[model samples]
Target: MPYDTERFDGDILFGHNSLQVVYFYSIENIIRGWAQHFRHDASKKSFYHVDTAIFEKLWRWARRRHRNKRWQWVKKKYFPKGNGRSWSFSGEVEGKRVYLFRAGNVPIKRHIKIRAAANPFDPEWELYFEERLVYKVKETLDRQWQRWRLWKEQKGNCPVCQQKMNPETDWNIHHIVWRSKGGKNTMDNCVLLHANCHRQVHAKKMTVLKPCPV
Candidate 1:
C-alpha cells in the first residue's frame, strides 16, 4: 500500500487501447525487490516463503541447529499459525517479523465525506481521491457513528436541563468526570448533553451530571 515510495515509477502497462491493463507487481516485485535492493544491509536482506508443512519441518531443523533459548523466543514471535492441510509461512528482516496475519481489513460504513479531484481529460466521468481514501472515509464514518450512539445512549435528553434534546445543534459528548481529574478518554466516561447545558455546567449555572456506569 506504500505506493508513494520513489522506488516505483508507476504501474507497468500492457496491451493496447481495447485490452489495456495495469500491472502492479506486488509480492514478486516488492518483496523480492526489498531483498535484492538491500542486500548490502544484512539486517534488511532476508525473505522466506513456504508451505505450512515445510515451515514446520524448517522450524524443527532450526530449533535443533540453534538449541538455544534465543531461537526458541524468536520462533514463538516469528512463526505463523498452521492448520493441518497447509501452512502460511513468515520471515524476519531487521528484527521485524513478517507474517501473513499482520495485516487485515476493518469494516467501513457506507457514505462518508471524501475529498477528490477529477481527471482533467475525463472531468465529467472520472474522479479520484489520493492514496488511502478508504481509510480516511472509515475514520470519518466511525466518528459520526460514535457521536450518534452517544446521543442515543443519553435517551435524547440533556442531563443538565433534564429535558428532551434536539440534534440540530444541541447534542454534544461531555465528559462525566472533569478532565483535570485524570479522567480517561472512554465511552463510559462520557455523556450526551445539549451544547447550552454543557456551557451551563461549565459556568456553574447547572450541576455536573453524575458519572453513570455505561
Candidate 2:
C-alpha cells in the first residue's frame, strides 16, 4: 500500500503484503497492463484475493488445448482444498508466486466500509478520508479486540490484587505457570496482568494467584 513505489499493475491496485487487484478489467487488459506496469520488482509474493475470473479464463483456455487433468497441475498445487472453487488468484510468475486479494471478501461487515466510501456523486470522497485513516481504524479495532479477549481470559480480575482488571491500560501476557517449571505456552496456562503487576510478579515481590483457572 506504499504510494511511494510508483504504484501500478493493470486494473490492479497494489496494497499491503505485495498485493494486486483486477477489478472490472478484461482478461486481455489485465495481462497486458500487468506486463507493462512499472515497479515490477517490488511485488514478489503477491498474496491477496485475486479476481476469480482470471482463473476461470485460464481454465477455459487450457481445457481447449490440453487434457483437463494436465492443465490442473498448477491449480492442484495451489488449491488442494475440496472442489477447488477458490475465490482468489494465485500462481507462479517467473518462479515467484503472485497473489491478489479482493476487498469484498473481508468478513467484518465489508459492506459498511465499502458503502461508506461509495458515494457515486463524488467518486473520490473515499480517497479524501483524511490521512492514513483506513490503516488507523483497522489497527485500532484489532488491538481493542485483542486486549478485551485477554482480559476476559483472566476472569475480569487481577489475581494478585483480587480487583477488577482494566484492559484499556498497559497489560502483559503473564504465564500462570512459569515456563521454567515446564509450563506450555498457551492461553490456558496464561494470565493477563497490568504492566506493574506483571513486573512485581516476575520480580518475586508479589505472589500471583495460582490455579486461577482461566
Candidate 3:
C-alpha cells in the first residue's frame, strides 16, 4: 500500500457545544489507496482508474472512521477544573460519538482541519497533464494557421502590385498593413502577396517613411 502521511495541526470539535478531537490522515493517501484497490484487474500491475462515485464513498468512510476514534478518546477525558460535568456525549452513530465541551458560557467553534501530504508523484502527474494540455493548444493553433493560409490563396492577387498570386512559395498573407501601425490580426486586414512583391513593399516602406513623423 503506497501511502503518504502528514501531521495535522488542527482539531475537530463536534456537537452543540465544542469538544476538541484531533484527526490525522492524508485524504490523498486514502484516494490513491482506494483507487488501487478497485483497479480493473486484481493480478495485473497497471494504473488504477476508479470512478469519482466510488472514490467519494471510500473517502467518506475513511474520514468517518478516523473521526469516530478521536471523538471517543476526548469524551472519556473531559474533566474541567471547576465543573463536575465538564462534557457530555449526545449519541453514537456508526462507531462515532458527538460530544459537547463548554468553556465558561460560550462554546468553542467546531472544525476539522486536515493537512494534505506533499505528493511525491505530483511532478510526474503534472508532466503528463501539461503534455495533454499543450497538445490541445497546438492542435488549435495549427488549424487556425491552415485556415489563414487557405484564405490568403483564395484572395486572388497581390494587393500591393495587383499581380496574380502563386500558391506554393510565392503567395503569402501580408499584414495588409503593418501590425505596428495599429493593424488588427483579422483576415479582412490581410492581403495576399507574391514573395518578392511582399519583400519590396516592406523595403520601400522602411526607406520612404520618415524616422520622426512629428
Candidate 4:
C-alpha cells in the first residue's frame, strides 16, 4: 500500500497500537467508494479518466526515491498517454477483475491508555469509547482479600464440597447464578470456588458432593 503522510497528522502515527484514528476499508469497498465518488464504471478498467492525475501525483512522489532513467522507462511502458481507460491488468494477473479508486487517509486520537501505578497489583490498562468508561480488569488481585469476600458471600469453602481450597491457581471466581439463568456481573451474584467445583456447577453433577455451607 502507498503511504500518504500528507493526509494524516504529524503527531499521530498510523497502524496498530498507534494513537491514530483511521478508517480501515477493504480493497473491494475502496474500489466501490471511489467509483461512487467519481461516477465511473468501476468494473470496466484498472485505470479511468480520473486515474491519470492521481497516478501522475504518485509518479512524482515515487520519482524522488527511484532512479530517474528506470522510472521514466517503466512509466513510458505502463503509463502511456490517452490509454488510461483500458489500463486494468487484474484479470490477466489475478484471475479476476479488480476495481480501485483514488483515496486519502486522515488521523484520529488515541482512545486506549496503559500505565503503571503505585499498586502493582491493580490493573493498568484502560479503554474508552467516545470518552466514556467501558471496562477494566486487574491482572492480579490480593488472593486473601478476594477469598475473604467470597467467604462472606458464600459462607466459607467451596459451596459444592464445603472444603477450603488453595487460594491461588486452584480457585476461580464463579457466578453464583448461571449466566443464562439471568445472572448479572455483580459481586452479590459471584463467589470463589475450587476450579473443579466450578466445573461441577456447570455439569450439574454435584449431587455426590457435600452440600454448601448453610
Q: Name the best candidate (by lDDT).
A: 2
* Model 4: worst 10 consecutive residues (lDDT sum): 125-134
lDDT of 4 by residue, 1-214 (tens): 2223343222222222321122122322443445444332223233333344444543453344345568555454434333244432111123423322333221112234533332322221111110121111222243345456666656556766778665444555555554444555466666666667666655562322323446
lDDT (Cα, tens digit) per residue for candidate 1, span 1-214:
1222333222211211111112222322543444434333323112222122234444554455456668646465435454221333354545554443311111213344444554323312111221122234234555666567666777776767778877766355555654444555477776767666665665563445643536
* Clashing pairs for predicted structure model 3, backbone only: none
**Model 2, which residues run further than 4 Å from truth?**
1-7, 12-147, 210-214
* Candidate ranking (lDDT, best to worst): 2, 1, 4, 3
Candidate-wise lDDT, in order: 0.44, 0.45, 0.38, 0.40
TM-score of each: 0.33, 0.34, 0.26, 0.29
lDDT of 3 by residue, 1-214 (tens): 2222221111222211332232212333343444444332232222222222322333333345456566445445431223344433233335665432221222222222222542323432322332333234333455356435533555555556656565444444455445545555465655545656656666565222211212
Model 3 residue 55 CA deviation in Å: 41
**TM-score of candidate 2 relative to the true fold:** 0.34
Q: What is the lDDT of residue 140 in candidate 1?
A: 56
Candidate 2, 35-58: lDDT as tens digits: 334223323223122334445444
> What is the lDDT for 1 in model 3?
29
